[model samples]
Target: MTEGSKLLSEMNERSREVFRRVVEGYLSSGEPVGSRTLTRSMSEKVSAATIRNVMQDLEYLGLLDSPHVSAGRVPTQLGLRMFVDGLMEVATVGPDDRAALDATLGSNERDVGTLLDRVGSALSGLTQGASLVLAPKREAPIRHIEFVSLAPDRALVVLVFADGHVENRVFRPPLGQTPSSMREAANFLNAVAEGKTLSDLRGHIAREIAAHRQELDGLAQDLVESGLALWQDAGESYERLIVRGRSNLIGAAEAAELARVRTLFDDLERKRDIVDFLELAEGGDGVRIFIGSENKLFSLSGSSLVVSPYMNADRKIIGAIGVIGPTRLNYGRIVPIVDYTAQLVGRLLSER
Candidate 1:
């Protein structure tokens, strides 16, 4: 069993009941739950004093804490983690939500960006938290390729894929590159692009260039290599990160919480950092949760992240989708939503 389970095993039934009630109350209201509150809701009608002693014991075990000396106890980060891992009962996604997700994502839309935006919007709205989506790199076969010279030194490479995706990228042409060389490059690409993805075409070109079998001149060869290299270096810039409903994070923040929300806003502004952080989910099999200081990016804000990796047709992890919200957010409810959404996205991507 996990450490959380072990800790739970050490607690007596009465202690467990009180702890569960405290965590549940805290999660629902984002406030400390007192002994009287637990006594009123507990099944066995335990006295308030007995519950208070149990809370003090739980607090000593590093599972609960009080915001003020006179106030009741709220679950600490450790307490929340323990509750989530051991005591909390996760709810299944309802039929309405499941149908909603299917209707939104199962549309005939082939555009990856539109699908991803819809996913972000849906998750954020449902969870009432900020949604983050890491879009996977596309590898559809190339349909057509063109090089349109923009300036003497710069040119635009327009690439169309078989999946109806078009990408335009700008590259600096080699010195002495002319219309003739650009045409030659386009012709070469069109010749070999049939049923081949950009990466595959790049490999074929590299092999041909190494064998010195191409008919293109030096300028055109350089242009082809530079254009391919540009896409490689761009590192999935074609709609990689989609963040939605950031304003939803600011709802119902107390004056004391404003600074933390500001800190979270600052964290969100660092898109690169968030992307890097999401990459950690790529290594895991299913849903993972990070609370409070568990994830460094949101440590200062004391936020929680519930993320799950979506996979490709080959069962390989491709990207991730998740939510960012306060530590007191509804873990039981939101967790299954994230898990189901990740599976749905994987299936949709596979079908495409």
Candidate 2:
């Protein structure tokens, strides 16, 4: 038998029950659990002998540890993983939970940052663990374009997006950029690029420029080329990432647990790593759950992520929404919560 299964099959019903209850108790109280603790309590059905033998098996499986202070078994990281993965029965979210998530989606016309803040706060409250909501670095679609020459060496480049957004950037020509070349580049973009994506727009402009190298004199060509390069570089900039729930770290009982949360915050603040986390949410399509140490991204912290990616009208993936909490989390109930939140996000974003 494989390792996980071998460990599980060796576990009888009584063993499973003892382990789950003990783990749950330890999680709740942050204390080591003793067999006498079980005998005197509600789970009194099993003999102390039965509980002891089972607890020993759990220790052998590397799921539980006998700490020196309490002479009682405490859940190891691996133990928590097993309980979260297969033993714990999660309750689905109820109507009240749905209402809580719905409240975060009420404002449809507000900007993205406000929406993200609300999501983070909502998740923190729901999970009682810290939450992080990463926002898209920028949101703009092409609307219209205009080029105006203010002087022989300077020109104003204007861009309009379909979202009724307008941005104006000024660029100085290399030496003498004739107004005609500026107009040509602007006219080409406005006419040919209406429904294209932002990345698509950049590529199209580059291709057009490259396909015809001899279309303008040195000064005019230099002005047009530099302007394109500058905008593309700006667009490549990252999206803002927001992490909420630093307070959760302070409550972790063990120093080891505290270090993990610190490392997680460090990674969440990194643009590239945060982007990877976002991508994981996007790939899952619906709610995705990561158990304790199941992923190195969150391994150090013994945390879990319940995430869902919300979509736009075209069914395009826009962003992810999720909650981060300790691994002892109730996944069965939280799964429904995360799923409902993603639905609300999609509905809110799509509303006219």
TM-score for each of the candidates: 0.79, 0.75
Best by lDDT: 1
Q: lDDT score, residue 244, model 1?
A: 90
Name the runs in model 1 displaced over 4 angstroms.
1-3, 142-166, 170-238, 274-278
As for candidate 1, its clashing pairs are none
Residue 66 of model 2: what lDDT? Answer: 93
lDDT of each: 0.83, 0.71
lDDT of 2 by residue, 128-199 (tens): 777766565344667777777878767777777777766667777566556676676666667656766465
Tens-digit lDDT string for candidate 1 (248-342): 87885677877998888876665657456556686567888999998777788878999999988999887899899888889898999999999
Clashing pairs in 2: 90-332, 137-239, 141-161, 142-161, 142-162, 143-160, 143-161, 260-300
What TM-score does candidate 2 get on C-alpha atoms? 0.75
Error of 1 at 260 (Å): 3.0
